[model samples]
Target: MSMFILVSGPFTDGRVWNEVVGRLRESGAEAHPVTLSSRPEADLETHIEDVVRLVDSLESPGELVLVGHDYAIHPVLGAADRRPERVGRIVHLDAGMPQDGDAALALVPDPSVHELLRAEGGPGPVPSPGPAQWQRWGSTEGLSVRQLELLSRLAAPQPPRTLTQPLRLAGTAASVPSSGILCTAGGMTVELVEALVRTGPPQFRKLADPRVGFFELATGHWPMVSCPDELAEVLLRAAAGEGRRLTVPEGESPFLGSFLFDTPERPRVRNGRLDLHMPKPDPGGAQGPRPAVLFVHGGPVPPHHEPAPRDSPLYLGYARYAASLGVVGAVVEHRLHGIADYAQSADDVAEAVELLRADPRVDARRIALWVFSGAGLLTADWIAAPPPWLRCLALSYPILAPLPGWGAVGSRFRPVDALRAGGGTLPPLVLTRAGLETPRIAATVEEFTAAAEETKALLEIIDVPHGCHGFEIHEPTDESREAVTRAVRTVLAHLEQPS
Candidate 1:
């Protein structure tokens, strides 16, 4: 009852995915490789319409899944935007991430490609690549001689408008489950670099989504040609809800955005049940103590909560991300709802900080707490006391006010109250709010922001337009990615500031 509607970009055809499709079908999954429009006048919208028509033609579309490569990443996303309910998920191959309001050329990491597009200003279908086209892309995707010949022969010039027309995201498209399959065999592309960036690119922004997953193949840009079997296996796993992996791990954090190839070093046991993800130090960088970030996850534990994994996905990637940027990152597995009050959660935070401070790899003087949603409750005491060892607090769509239905407890913990009772001088704080999140709980950001102002606390609130309560963990839009990067930078900036 699921289907992978494989979408190809310009310069290629449906045949490109033939091998992957075969492998997928062999695994008992329905797969279809869609050839994009080759007409000279076809624009971005037109391309998306074509794909939509194809999906509509299906007698019974069980669960539409879009698997896009290269430029197809945009059109397929647009199709999903136009038919969100029908489309269950999307998978972005090494192809660049779609940027709403930007052209394909704009997403390329190499600016020379942009220059080339501009110099060859278009009137109709873009010209096909010369015979040397394979010489250029083949090496990147690790194309074999036959693969190069076939791709070169099938390579058709795209409609100039297709590359130029800006992508239009209806917001709903980002809400769907998504995954990224990064190609690692070729020279680093923008998509690959963005994942490791301290502040990642718009395309990689959705990586923060808790629902989205990531994978990497030890092949070139065209994994279909270079590593079809491996690519197919990953696609199958992703479709089955197991796709997220740190393709080329580095100072990667738990997704909500992550770190580089070598990041997210193997998890080491810290205090009982606490897992630490440290970034392998940069070889060329100076040797010294690094800043630290303690990530606290949110959510109330169900009566019989099902544990996902021993390692924290969001925190692991985040820790690695921080490590990539020259810092030590750690994630704590605290009792989500073991106690009636917030004291236990606060104690867990304190324990994490104590452990980090004692670690030889950490700079005890500089550490920050990056809290997500419900975990903000634990920040109350720290916000009131302003611990000297803590540099700042970065909150993501936090639940600041005390809610009656949180759990049956003695008291409804209130962050605003704690800040108000503070000595008026709190640790510098940076908070992010998803603009599109539910009005009731989302209003917590404003409420706490106002309270922080009244208490003369140093606070900065970042509003991510079109982002929902858990935007980073599900899907990312330009707004959410930028918001996360900005908040992280704020925390780092605060830490870097001379005391």
Candidate 2:
């Protein structure tokens, strides 16, 4: 089981997570809360070190969920970037998203500057809003007298230095999975959130990240104090990587004979969570080791352990077809696990490739990648540095540009930008463009194809006339069928090419 590390923002301590920790512990997860120095002199680095030290002491740093609320997000992110491999995911509670070069509080501009001075204490030390403030912030709808009293004691003032300190992310934290939980139940409004995301400060803007699962709760900013039970469940689901998982049911087989292969009974753990489906070897071992194809299914894959079926009809029939053609075919479940950041997703593909090469039934030196839809972005790394084993890449309606919605990490994920850096010549490449695709999608692919040619990338561009995106399976017309047929032939033919 993964462990949960609860981190409180300024003015509060570990006690903020008391209710949340209790519920998580009961759920059998190893939950603990870390307190940051609230001393007037406590700066950003002081808090960052505090969290990093706790993470370092963990038995399994990789099995961690670092939950940060409000101001604590900076230090939590600092620790994550410092030790990217140690932290698995970061959960932000009513906090703004920080970009690569943003300062802590720089992104969270208040709705009005007047509200800050409107409170008591003459703007001396950032006065607490008192009971009325708490009520407006969120509800104590179900909280007992003790909970409310405890909340009062938890409110205090910490140094403003933490916010003033500029946050410098080296793109490492982008590798760590992340999620955001917005408080709509309190004084916050959805329309206001949308406006903030649109207007300025990178913080609110990141909430719209397609990869970061967006959730709303009808509680105040202090949901831990107001609705710990409901808050705990959200964190639990986030920890479990519940994204907009879309599952496609197993499709009808169109192979000469029913697949002689067996579906693995259960998922396996490799670098991360993964499931490998392979074709059963021919009877009496007719076809020994053969060239392999790793099917990279696109996903916002379904929730944890729930129907992450990557084997669409196209993949199923293709896998069977590969087997009949005397080639080993493997379908991989590229469950994002909310690590939708391109860097980590690419790492996953790398790990899966290694697993494929290690299989005795696969011709390790002759492997190919077949990627479809959104997963096309992951091909950037492979394209930039084509492994000798990577004979060819068959990209269907591939996305070779930076998709801000996908929370792309950096310019390297942008193919055209990466191509400017100049690298090894890409191996034989076959790119199929769906004629009916949106103009933006079509333009990006066209741009990529043109750019690839300048780099002298051995490339083949195939246009499927009158074919829509995913037409290969969903709306398979004669044109679509021929296009799919060409894709299969392209990979095999590329394999036959002499080095």
Estimate, for each residue in 316-360, the C-alpha lDDT of model 2 and write its tens digit: 656556555556666666644332345566777788888888877
lDDT, candidate 1, at 126: 56
Instruction: For each candidate in the order shown, give its overall lDDT on alpha carbons.
Output: 0.68, 0.65
Q: Which candidate ranks first by lDDT, i.e. highest?
A: 1
lDDT tens per residue, model 1, 289-362: 77888888765432233332225345565666666666666777776542243566677778778888888777
Residue 70, model 2: Cα distance from true site in angstroms: 16
The residue ranges of model 1 lying beyond 4 angstroms of the native Cα positions read 108-116, 119-124, 135-141, 187-205, 245-499
